[model samples]
Target: MVGVMRSCLRSLLKLMNSIIGMVGTGMILYSLWMIRLWHQHLDGGGSISQIPWFIYTFLGLGISLCLITCSGHIAAETANGHCLSCYMVFVFLVVLLEAAVTADVFLNRNWEEDFPEDPTGRFEEFKKFVRSNFEMCKWIGSLIVAAQALSILLAMILRALGPDRGGYYDSDDDYTPARLPLLKPPVQQPPYAVDSHFKLKNDVWNTNR
Candidate 1:
């Protein structure tokens, strides 16, 4: 039953990792598309250094996500304690970052002041998009956060119940008591044998005397 549960959790973690990889890939593609559009719009009017900073930011984020996704998948497949631990730490950091950003957005009235101005106005457009699709975005974000949280939990549990050195789950029953060694009976001899031998010797000695 424990093994089955571990297998299910591993499968779920792998699926979440796949989703994370897909999100990373999508971000990378979107950043590239944006760059292409920026190039076309500029038409050599601006130098390469003038490329928007958000593109690079998204690109970096996507690459980091891809790395984390790969780590998570490896951890899930191997079921190693160390791998699962590190994977959980990485995932926790990501969750913490997202939560911090979300809290800042909700609690800080002047959160926009923390960020530099974007000349391309893509940031404002992104905010508008979120506002327009608030319900969809909210559900999606909640699902993503839930998935990450669940993944971390599963990783921690699997780490606690990790495979042995041979890469196999130890099937020994923890509740069963160990068998004790059996006791052996002592060998027995006739009680009259020694007395009979002594009597025969005494009779012989008396006759000799």
Candidate 2:
């Protein structure tokens, strides 16, 4: 019975992992599309639009990381044990960083204006702004960096707890057996028998007997 339960759990984990894989792949594709859009916007003198592009990039990255974390959770649950703490922490940190970036982008709309419009003054102003806002940008960047670092650490831990070093589901192995239940043979019943000595008490029955 315990083995059956374990087998069921493993099958469930594999299905969940497949779902996570699809989501991860979709996120990566979306990220690529966003990058292409950003480049087009830049070519069309839409540097201002890059803000949203950056936001989308960050969102895609966050989603990708989440899918990865989910995969890890499934693996851990099926093989070693379910420990979602690391995955949760990583997701929380990424969400916090994404929220901070979104807020910063909205709050500082004129941040792009900080850069000089004139080509000659562009480099100088860019440098000056970097120097002046170094502290603030550094803090924000640090938060994002910290979140990424934590996510990576969690992924590593999950991989270590996973069944394979590659940290992916074993596609080569037959999973159907894990999903099927054990069968038992049906009980047999005895055939009905009658006593030949028993007879009906009636006028027609007496003639027949």
Best by lDDT: 1
CA deviation > 4 Å runs, candidate 1: 44-51, 164-209
Off by over 4 Å in 2: 53-63, 66-78, 82-209
**C-alpha lDDT of candidate 2 relative to the true structure:** 0.53
Q: How does residue 145 of candidate 1 score in lDDT?
A: 84
Model 2 agreement with the true structure over 94-200: per-residue lDDT tens digits = 56766785576569976666433432233344458767998987785565455445544544444444443233655635665665554644465658655455533
Candidate 2, poorest ten consecutive residues by summed lDDT = 114-123
Q: In the order shown, what is each candidate's alpha-carbon RMSD?
A: 8.1, 14.4
> In model 2, how large is the Cα lDDT of residue 55?
37
Q: Can you give the lDDT of residue 190 in candidate 2?
A: 57
- What's the distance in Å from true for residue 95, model 2? 11
Task: Please give each candidate's TM-score.
Answer: 0.74, 0.35
